[model samples]
Target: MREISLDRLRTLVAIADCGSFADAARALHLAPPTISLHIADLEERFGAPLLSRKRGQVRPSAVGETLVKYARRLLAEAEQALQDVKRQVEGKGGRVRLGASTGAIANLLPRALELLALHHPGIDLQIAVLTSQETLARLKSGALDVGLVALPQQATDGLTIKRWRRDPVMAFMPAGWKCPARVTPQWLAVRPLILNDSSTRFSRLTAEWFASGGQHPVPRIQLNFTDAIRSLVAAGYGAALLPQEAVAPVQDPRIAMRPLRPALWRELGIAHSAEDIDRPTQHVLDALWSLRLR
Candidate 1:
């Protein structure tokens, strides 16, 4: 017996479905001769005619009807198998390790992760809360797959960085404090400040903002975490310059958020190891890109 051919079976089913050899060739993008050859080869192999043809019309012979039924199921299964392979290879079902700062984890990552879970449930998303410096170090050592960090990380050879978003730095003060729609650095300098710790980029930027105005204000309290700083500001302890992400979520009635005069902004970015931007990491990036964050 001649070996069975899926191509011939598919072509036979196509001819039966379309009701003519010429139509089958058009549908399958095959030359008419190629379609004729496929039917002939199948008939020769099975030792039975597969088509019943008359002027201006075509139908499958009894034998062709049986073959076509099996062909449809077989082709569908084959398509499904191919899709399964592609999904696995593209990291749709794999684990993605992600790192980001506390502010990102609290304000930004939750929404992105929720979207990822809704669409790609098979991907295991593992997240770690780390400082920008810690995230970069972990990325270099292959301990992390991807990171959301402040822009301009240490120049290194093995990392690919892309700008993600810029969060405006807003000034947070106690309620009933008189301030303009946009507070100036000179105005901020006179208020008792509660700043992010010196290790954080926010601290450096806030310091630079004041120095540019030929002023500097010592903090009444210095802390690394945004929520704690917000707590102090809400309790009437001091004012703070915090990213909009950190200030937007506070529910305390004592807190008021205002833009900076020059509109200071903190740039966030995505970084991955140049050597290991595998499929799962890219899926996470794709999910993040789908979000429109302010």
Candidate 2:
């Protein structure tokens, strides 16, 4: 029997994640036939079917489920091996893959990246905009060098997390709306709301805060992006609860912001794999720390 190739394992994992050959091919930038052939080859070597296709949907067989679990682990290790070799030769000049939540990217990370660019010109930076959960998953899988995430209440194992900054959540109201000096949960609940989509950590945090007060603020518009939420608020659609940094870029005169009473705040932080900190990762961390101090 032939040994399974790294390429085949990678394809299997992608297929398992993406749920179909066409989708997996798109994700891996390979043709559908290529992905099918790779999976077929792997099954041939193992002498067991890896996937079951029924009614145009693909499900992993029992053997496929077991293989996928091991395949993901092997692929993660292989990627780490390449990163390790690159780090040895490149030192601080290697590429750093960083991920950030939308709120952090609006202000915090751009400033840190500018500082990193000035100090380490040789280090190439690749930035990904992702939700907090996605950022954590990428960091754990060795897919990201470092991540800027909203600090969770409980820390995950095998990760080093440092508090970067605290950003207050504010209510954005229309220009003529009469808002108190300090808005309360009761006041916010009465206003027409334009809320962040339920998927984001920010949305969950906001929801929990309101729920704590026994109020459910119904949103007329549910937005996924921070900018879109700002636009809706500015257009007089409804008020929104967002991080202070997220609304910094908007200069619309139609919207006014008021601080919430008891001051809800979100903590942003830098997180990286505890076991895999390399020169490039350290360099970026140093830059971020310097920015924090400034």
Candidate 3:
């Protein structure tokens, strides 16, 4: 069987809606003969007269009513598909897969998400908490669209890593402890320390900072989650070094945040495939960039 053309379906729908062939032709900017031919073709295909004249106004025959009902749904679905494609092209709707650390997602990404909601509410971000290395690997393997990862990462092919933000690594300790104006490697080394896992890039970076001051001390415990580490610090388990977002207003009285004396920093980068970036991903990137520190 031959497939029906969209033009005929559109004409039929318009005529049914307008209640007259002439009105439908005028509404569709088509000739009267074209409208008549559309109904004739539809009736011929289904072997039934589709429209009838009743009380000087046009109406659908019983068979025509059934076909028109189906036609309306099919046309509505087609229109919805067209609109969805247009929204994607306009950067107004689609899913953008992204990866970031728990710290970034907690303290940093909320502002970016707010901006995204205000501007591109139609775009959904699928977030995964992942390490810098895992995020980079997923990006290269085409599993993710964007990534927020620790800085100084080794270069990977087919990926572009843009500098995103730099946050100072601050000492988080129990508020009741005797504190110094600035925590140093020597001061922190002697205390029980909670730090990121040895497998993490930030752990290695912090280790290097300690090594700079001739202090190579093991942490009391190691874990990757930043919030949990902060909790341990509040309980006086030890002082942990972690990044503080400059704009974050800390009001927790259980723990105090102090700057590091040697000026250690936790840097982050945005990674993506070095290809023509799609609009949805680009919008997310723009939102992330809005949180850049200086």
TM-scores of the models, in the order given:
0.65, 0.66, 0.77
Give candidate 3's error at residue 98 in angstroms: 2.8
Error of 3 at 203 (Å): 2.8
Worst 10 residues of 1 by lDDT: 243-252
lDDT of 2: 0.83
Indicate which candidate wins on TM-score: 3
Q: In candidate 3, residue 198 scores what lDDT?
A: 91
- Candidate 1 on 1-294: residue-level lDDT in tens? 857888888898899899999999999999999999999999888899989988888899999899999999998898888876687677777777899887777678877888888988878889998888898889889888889888766677798887887888889999879978889988889889998888887688889888888888888888877778878898899999878864245467888888887778888888888774667678888888765455
lDDT of 3 at 266: 88
lDDT per residue as tens, model 2, 57-151? 88889999999999999989999889767754666477889998766776677777788778777688899988878888998898998888876
- What lDDT does each candidate get? 0.84, 0.83, 0.89
Clashes (backbone N, CA, C under 3 Å), per candidate, total 0, 0, 0
Better of 2 and 3 by lDDT: 3
| Least accurate 10 contiguous residues by lDDT in model 3 | 243-252
Candidate 3's C-alpha runs over 4 A off are 1-5, 36-67, 84-95, 117-124, 141-143, 180-190, 210-222, 261-263
Q: Is candidate 1 or candidate 3 better by TM-score?
A: 3
Clashing pairs in 2: none
